[model samples]
Target: MAMSKQQRAAVVAILVAGLLGGAAILFTGKGGGSGEAGHEHGEHAEQGEHVDHDDHDHGHAHDKPAATPASAAAAAAAPAQAADQPHVIKLTPEQVQQAGIGIATAGSAPLRGSVDFPGEIRFNDDRTAHVVPRVAGVAQAVPANLGEQVARGQVLAVIASTALAEQRSELLAAQRREALARATYAREKTLWQEKISAEQDYQQARTALEEAQIAVQNARQKLVAIGAAESAGKDGKDGKGGSLNQFALRAPFDGIIVEKHLSLGEAVKEDASVFTISDLSSVWAEFVVSARDLDQVRVGETVRIRSTASESQAEGKVSYVGALLGEQTRTAKARVTLANPGMAWRPGLFVTVSVLGAATQVPVTVAADAVQQVDGSSAVFVAVPGGFAVQPVKTGRSGGKLVEITEGLQAGARYAAANSFILKSELGKASAGHEH
Candidate 1:
């Protein structure tokens, strides 16, 4: 099993000659066939998939050539270059298409970026009203129910109050006094003109008439203040009996009643919020913006409002932006006025508001899905000989479906725009194999 010194010297000489030959090939690789040099290069590597398999298996020194200084340098440089090289996923163009990976050419596009904010659907305050009974009374009849729609002048409820009866009686008495004074003043003026009475008596009667007229006017005005009519029913005669104390409460405008606190025969206060009515034709999409992004959102800008509860989407303009932020939230409140013609945007519904910005054209861009995370870097799978190469890219502005690439890719370069995660998955598998 052991060789003599003469045989050992011959084997060493053969190894030394092989080393020199391999080094010449490595040094002149540019001029030689690359396929042959690649195989020869494999023979020189010390570790990782390039071990000298033939010599180790045969237990013979001559099975592989010796490695020289030039070959050593070249072999060491191969892996280092590979470490920095773009990962290549070997797949034919047909395979890429068959796998449902969408290919897109990176190019110029108009990018309209948007800032998103969480929001909620709210009642349009201008169209919302908290209905209150302006006069204290007992609710005799409540016709309007919660969530019922009512028109302007529609009777919402009927109330009975003894105060109303007293006020009406005062008005009637004032009118009677005014009428009596008017008759007396006329009689005194005629008597004065004919010298049948003293001028002082006529003047006194005129003053009494003026005071009575003022009292009648004051009583009528007091009834108007409480939303009561000066007279009851069409006959113009005051109500039969209890009708004088009855007050009919009417809706101020056409809207749906959202809340109701009054019930039949319930005693109510003068300032009780008996009902809440809101017009559903329009609503507010309220949102809060951070201080840093306050400059981006402004009045008159358009925004797309979407709801999470359903597939409801609508467009509206920024109607209001608060000048100050909340002390606890540190966020400025903003609202968009959305026309809810179908009443789809209900109050308390969650929504997302995407405030649109002005559009600008950029030189290089790709579909948003084309970009992926590659070793903490943004990269795209670019078209290569077999399939695609992981091309590192610096992303700039992003809009609807495209992202601006400021670097690492050029215009007209095709790349995987969809299902590119397949390529990333392949790269992961390759990495795991190498580690193992």
Candidate 2:
């Protein structure tokens, strides 16, 4: 297979060119395949990224609906729980007895319409007195003490009065002169009858006797005006050692001595008040009525007086009502006279006067004690399955033993009529525990 040099060279050149062309084609095909594969892989990666983003958005959308139902379920369950767990107080039968709890059914009843006014107990002015010394004197002895019960004409105190003494002295002197005059008149008459003396002399003696008798009478009247006791002496003279200065201050009527100003050996004036006595067997309940209610508080109207300090009540009639209104309060004064047999009604005690009006029927009425306060509203405790539940109410007129329920209560409902405050206390304790 030896050939010439030119032919061999030509063949080698052709072979080298062919080999170079094949290498170029193979390199171009491999480069094109790698570029196409890289482009396809990039497209797939972008598409996968878009698909992952869509799945994340879809998951968020599903989560929103799911969360709504959970919240709705929780809200729905809240009301059911509230319905089951109302404010309740459980008590056994023994506990109820120990607590003195009582229950009664609410029903229709008639309530008396009434108007209440604040009042106070005061002394009956008709039976009160202020004792004064009639003459200037020194208090020798004080026999009546403050708060001592005294009878009419009872000696309250003894006073040594010079003015009274002078009056008595003048009476005694005049009486002596009167006795002498009487004797002289009798003697003059006998002389004139017997002709033992001149008629002119007898007449003069008679005139003198008459003048002396008038003077004695005048002096006796002066003593009587001064409240001086009648003398025991034969000639209208004091027999007890002429102690005319001793003046006894006596009570004017049966009463209790409420005040005393005179003390032993103290000088008092002629018009000085020495004692204050009051007959406390009865008292006046004085009340202030507004101008709007003045027409209702007429004299002679019957009223019920209840004490605010204690559970005491009395009945009386209106004795007085002031015609004029007070300037400061714009109210009129009214009073009721009540008999105080045991003296239990003391002055200065606060009271309420209830004047009854017409009565009216109410749909639902409960005992006054059954009403209690809950959450700043009037409420009544109603019997329930487990215990008692508080029922808020609106109240209207109240009188005697019943109160009208305007709302929040129904007829024939059983409720705690007595000792209802126990339930209130128990409910308050439970509420406090939950808060803590």
Candidate 3:
């Protein structure tokens, strides 16, 4: 179908006019000469509006968002919403792994509430002793050194005492007298039976023998009371008087010699505490509790103890709780007995004691590391369709490892358990970009 010349001419003119109009619109939009400034101002105004819109969107996203398709679409459409919405984060599985992020499922956990108190590790007083020589003496041989471990009845030092020598001499003399009196009494009895000795003679001899026996017993008891009888040998004799003045200071129990005050040839008093021995297998963690906290701490309650110097922890039982408060501090003394395996919990080490209270059953709980601070609120990075989402949470009681989520999260929700801080860092970067 061929057209006439006039019809073709009219079609060409209409095409030329449409092309020119489109070029004019494009030039005006690109800020052509006269309209350039107005165009730039309009762009700046649009950017300001975008910033304002984002700020408003972020405010609502941090609170609770309804679980609906519209909200989901809104969350997906806005990349900046990842920083604004508490329920959205933009990360692929590969990116999440590259960031060293870990996931944990929220679930029910037994929440053991606890109270903490500052404490100090100390020697168990029951197993600690200050060794003293009952008799004043000169230290002859100092065998035990400081920090040396000794068993019960082990000799710590040997002392030479004039007083001990005299006591032993008296015992020896009494024994000899008792033997002689026994022989004389027997001879007198025989003579009287034969009518060769008088009855009075036999009675005097018997009385003398009884007195001698009493003297011997008295001397023996004196030595026993002074801790000298054990070192006196089997026959109750001190090496036939050669070691009459020698007194051995022995350990009262299995312990380590923590203090040594006496040296060889040093003179010591009878009541002087020359050595301090303590058992390090177990130690006491002593703390003070206020009057209001007295009821919370009780004997036989299990407590968690942590060392201040290191990442060391142990479980202990409350051994003692004072009935009276301190006169000056107005606080009651409490103690926990902890087993010091390998003697790691040394005395004088500072510790924190956590007294566990009743257990609670929480419906939703996550690892403590999963909860991170986002926008100044407690939040968790929850896994969503394409990436992880920031879920604002209301937290309740928390143990060291797990924390209870009171709201804003549900059971079976996967979250970043370890290295969640990485996500926080990334979120901060994204927010900073938008801010600029």
TM per prediction: 0.62, 0.71, 0.71
Q: Write the per-residue lDDT of candidate 1 for residues 1-436, one digit (tens) a residue.
A: 9999999999999999999999988878766677677778676654544345655666776756878999999999989866744387889868887899998899999988789999999999999988777778999888889999899978888888778878989999999999999999999999999999999999999999999999999999999887877765511222344377788787889999989999999999988999888998999999999999999999999898889988777888999999998999999999999999888989999999999999999999999888999999999999888778889999998775789999999999999999999999988887776655
Model 2: ten consecutive residues of lowest lDDT: 230-239
- For candidate 2, write residues 1-436 as lDDT tens digits: 8899999999999999999999999999999999999999999888988877876878756445445787999999987766444477777777878998898999998877888999999999999998987889998778799999999978787778888878878878888887888798889889999999889878888888888888888888876665556452311222354367877778889989988998999999988998999999999999999999987888888788999988898888899999999899999998999999898889899999998776788889999999998889999999887678889999999886799999999999999999999899998888777555
Model 1 misplaced stretches (Cα beyond 4 Å)? 1-109, 234-242, 363-436
Candidate 3, 48: how far from true, in Å?
26
What Cα-based lDDT does every candidate model obtain? 0.87, 0.85, 0.88
Estimate the overall C-alpha local distance difference test score of candidate 2: 0.85
lDDT of 3 by residue, 173-227 (tens): 9999999999999999999999999999999999999999999999889888878
Reference-based TM-score, model 1: 0.62
The segments of candidate 2 whose C-alpha lies over 4 angstroms from its true place after superposition are 1-86, 170-228, 231-242, 326-330
- Separate clash counts for every candidate: 0, 0, 1
